[model samples]
Target: MAQIQASIEIDAPIDKVWSIVSDLDSEPKFWKGTKEVRNISKEGNTITREVTIAFKDSKCMQTVTLYPKEKIQIQFTKGVIEGTKALTLAQTGSKTRLDVIWDMKLTGMMGMFTGMIKKHIQSGSEQALESIKQEAQR
Candidate 1:
């Protein structure tokens, strides 16, 4: 398993950050790599989403586990993708510290070509964090 982790401090309450991060439908806006997300199914803490990433050649199906105001974890349920996870909204002092961890395994050629793309995605994640911070602080 490979993990790409990024963290940033937001000058807002945990609840504030949770509102934006928990809404999976609007993820594409702040998350640079996410081009679009459609909610396929939802029940309790589980939601199935179809997402098209910026560099990805095709859409991917993701099964996301939500923990209300605490965290949200997403993993690929189908398609060429292997694995992915995002941990959101960790509290630190009066502000909120959000951390996202992604673990992925590509098949065939995509696996070999993942290095540069992985770095780009990680950089985008970091930028997304800063965007969230600015929004929350406003």
Candidate 2:
């Protein structure tokens, strides 16, 4: 599986950071790779949704579990990708540290290009975190 991780420290409180990250519907605003999101179902803090990604404009089903201000776990259950993407928050002094980790691999014939796409995913993740930090700090 290809693994990518990126993190940013926001000059804001944990709650402030969480407020921005927890809004799943607004993901496309910060995460450029995520073109769109459509909710399929929700139960408590967990939600099943279909996401249109920038990679060939492919659609993927993901199970997202929100852990309040601590973490958000996204499990890719269908489509081109298979694995997990986790967002974790840590408080340092008065600031919040947001970390994004993508542990995934492309499925089927696309699997061979996993290594080739790793850098693109990593760059997108870093850009997303930076965008999140900017929004939260504002």
Best TM-score among the predictions, by candidate number: 2
Candidate 1 global TM-score: 0.92
User: Candidate 1: lDDT of 24?
Assistant: 80
Provide the overall lDDT of each model, using Cα atoms, as 2-decimal numbers: 0.83, 0.95
- Per-residue CA lDDT of model 2 for 38-71, tens digit only, reads 9999999999999999999999999999999999
- Residue 100's C-alpha lDDT in candidate 1? 90
Per-model TM values vs. the true structure:
0.92, 0.98
Cα RMSD (angstroms) for every candidate in the order listed: 1.4, 0.6
Query: For residues 1-138, could you state the per-residue lDDT of candidate 1 as single tens digits?
Result: 456899998889999999888878888889878888889899999999888877655688999999987888898987666797787777788989899988987656678767766788788889988888887898
Error of 2 at 10 (Å): 0.8
Q: How many residue pairs clash in all the candidates, one count each? A: 0, 0
- Any runs in candidate 2 off by more than 4 Å, and if so which? none
